[model samples]
Target: METMNVQEHWQNMALDQVPLALAGHEVPWVREARLAAFERFAARGFPTRRDEAWKYTDLSILAKRASFAPDNIPPDAPSEAALNAWMLSRQNVHLMVFVNGHYSPELSYPRNLGPGVQLESLAGMLDENAQLPPELFDAVHEHTVLDALNTAFTTDGAVLRLAPGTRLKTPVYLLYIASGYGVSIYPRNIILAGEGAEATVIEHYMGTLDAHNFTDAVTQLELASGVTIDHCKLVQEGSAAFHIAGVHARQKAGSRFVSHSFALGGKLVRNDITSSLDGPDCDCRMNGLYLLNGRQQADHHTCIDHQAPRGTSRECYRGVLDGASRGVFDGKVIVRPGAEKTDAHQSNRNLLLSRQAEVDTKPQLEIYADEVKCTHGATVGQLDEDSLFYMQSRGIDAETARSLLVYGFLNDVIERVPVSELRSRIVDMVLDRLPQGESIKELL
Candidate 1:
């Protein structure tokens, strides 16, 4: 397949909004960073469907079109009534709100909490910690072009750090609300947990307006010895949103990292998750659930690399596809040559509701170590016809029966989520959006 050059197109693409630097008087460092990122993006360009990793999802639609910049501030802060109407309300959580790519401290809640827990913005962290992580620019050499693309163009996101011996009872909510007005925005994030520290972090993405936006998000996680990090991510952007997210985790000896990803929005969404067990006795678990409807598309690609001995990793991801939506899952586990006694288990399953709904799943395992145990598998199908029929025979209508079966199928994974409030919230949202009418059978 021949690839077309999109740099010229991007350059000529008329943008309504420009960066803060170009929009007005600029900060030196901000201008420098923006210029550098633009050059990098120009050099690499967008990935085509021919690209092995992007074979199923194409960027042609994005490359050819000119998008508005991350500009536009709402006339007023979201009213309390408006916030109440939102699905994932920020009333309880320690919330941080971002409009476009800029932090809106006025809309954000107070960051009041116990010692050792720091909830701050990425810009602040970059200002204080001059030493940037090496992974920011060079981590993707191992594989994939999405990481490089995100790093090259990312603007602002959140920074979460848990100090040594600190335990956070409340989950930290990092909320990104995009009001692109038909523009594109990139969000970059970094999270760190010190030795023996424990915390549960919730990363939420929601849109307040209808925008043909593109979000290239990246999250880098570093865990020290004996630390436990529970990371929960929910992507519920608007229907017009295009989201590409990457999550990378590096774990030290005796540290445990648990991650759960929920994908429920965006026209085109992809999640690339990678975990490296670089220390012995490390344990990591990766779980994901994506429910797509209409013309939505969701892709999840994961890699678990065991670089040390006596490490264990487990992964399980389930997807629900309805209408003309599509879903993809590619999971790979690699055990290095010297990594002995490694145990890894993985599985991917999908449920399709409509005839047009489709899913493609691939689970791969590469082991060079003789002493490792690993397993992986994938399944794609619809609601069990027999189960639906059985329920329908018991006075349940077809739609109600289907909804019940779908809920039952997804409930197993929902139950595994660590946060009770968050889990319940997600469950209610999914149930509310189900295709069944007001039949008691579906509710049951």
Candidate 2:
């Protein structure tokens, strides 16, 4: 049997099905844009190691072996017990669930959303002929093939809108679950926060362990002046799954945006986050943590663009790798011309718990303004032996001591999570996944 080239494989499986898949939903300009995006994907194919941005990660195996056929059949609604296990149970919060990229109304709780807030499915909105925002189907940047693919094939996801000056006391949960084997799913989400609005959002992705699934998701956020949003994303897909996700955010004057990302599962994962501070006095903060082991691979790329005067941005990402797993972090902060008084900082840190584990980290700062303050740095190393010894001297065994140290290292980022319930769940999840995790349970 001959192996198909990455470009040939995707062009045969995905590119040809765009038109028919979106047959009835095609408005003239929308259809044209989807076709154009498909053309772009066909021309560029997948990013290779030769590309500078992808130099530290490779997609050859995924492109050749992974499935590209769309999974149109929606899986059964999760049982009540299963839903309870997966949902973030709390008062005043709303939950929306999607199974294999299709909304499951039976499993979602859409009640009690106060005035000035709108929550609905993207597919539902399109079906009802609701006016869709132009940014919903557009690419946030011009440089990626995955974004083009997502734009061409996105079927269903959550859409959220908040009216001006509206403040929600509780967060909104968007849960995506993959159930079948050898399937591909694309989820697209759009969020619009009106002026002076305040809200929190959580996006959670999970899947069955036996499925050989591929998920490509995109999320776009538009924050108006004086708005503040706390956003968090958790990726806990199957260990055999391939996940690629992108988040693009634009902030207006006096707006504030904070992002938290957690990557705990998947065979091959790539996360891309880009934020643009386009108006004066805006601030952005990005933080992430990835736990990988057992031959897994995770790559994260982030870009922060300071386009206006008196803007500020900060980013910190941490990784913990064991067994033969690998990790990559590439972060860049840019201060454009005339963006004086800009303050930006970026850092990437990694912990290797096994001899075979490896990591590649790069932090960059590009400042065009003469009066800007910017700094970037990256570090890759193992846990401190002296600290482990200190714990061991306090009656803790070697394995327990190591686990405690590892948890302490990761807790730095976890502690910054603003939602108390979510933060507690994340802490428990991280401890349970660490090496010899059970031994440190009593200590926690």
Best by lDDT: 2
TM-score of each: 0.89, 0.94
Off by over 4 Å in 1: 1-38, 72-76, 87-91, 127-144, 437-444
Which predicted model would earn the best TM-score?
2
Q: What is the lDDT of residue 49 in candidate 1?
A: 77
- Global lDDT of each candidate: 0.76, 0.83
Looking at model 1, the pairs that clash are none
lDDT of 2 at 112: 88
For model 2, residues 1-444, the per-residue Cα lDDT tens digits are: 122454566566655565456522556655666677777776677778888988977877666754564578878776788767766883547888889888888888877889999999987776565777755565545436888887777778889999999997789999899887877888888889999999899999988666778898988889999999988999989988889988888999989999999998888889998889999999999999999999999999998989999999989899999999999998989999988999998989899999999998988888898789898888899989899889888988888888888788888998888888888778778888876776666666
lDDT of 1 by residue, 96-189 (tens): 7766666778878745767887777776655454445544546443245555555445556777778888887777777777764565666777
lDDT of 1: 0.76
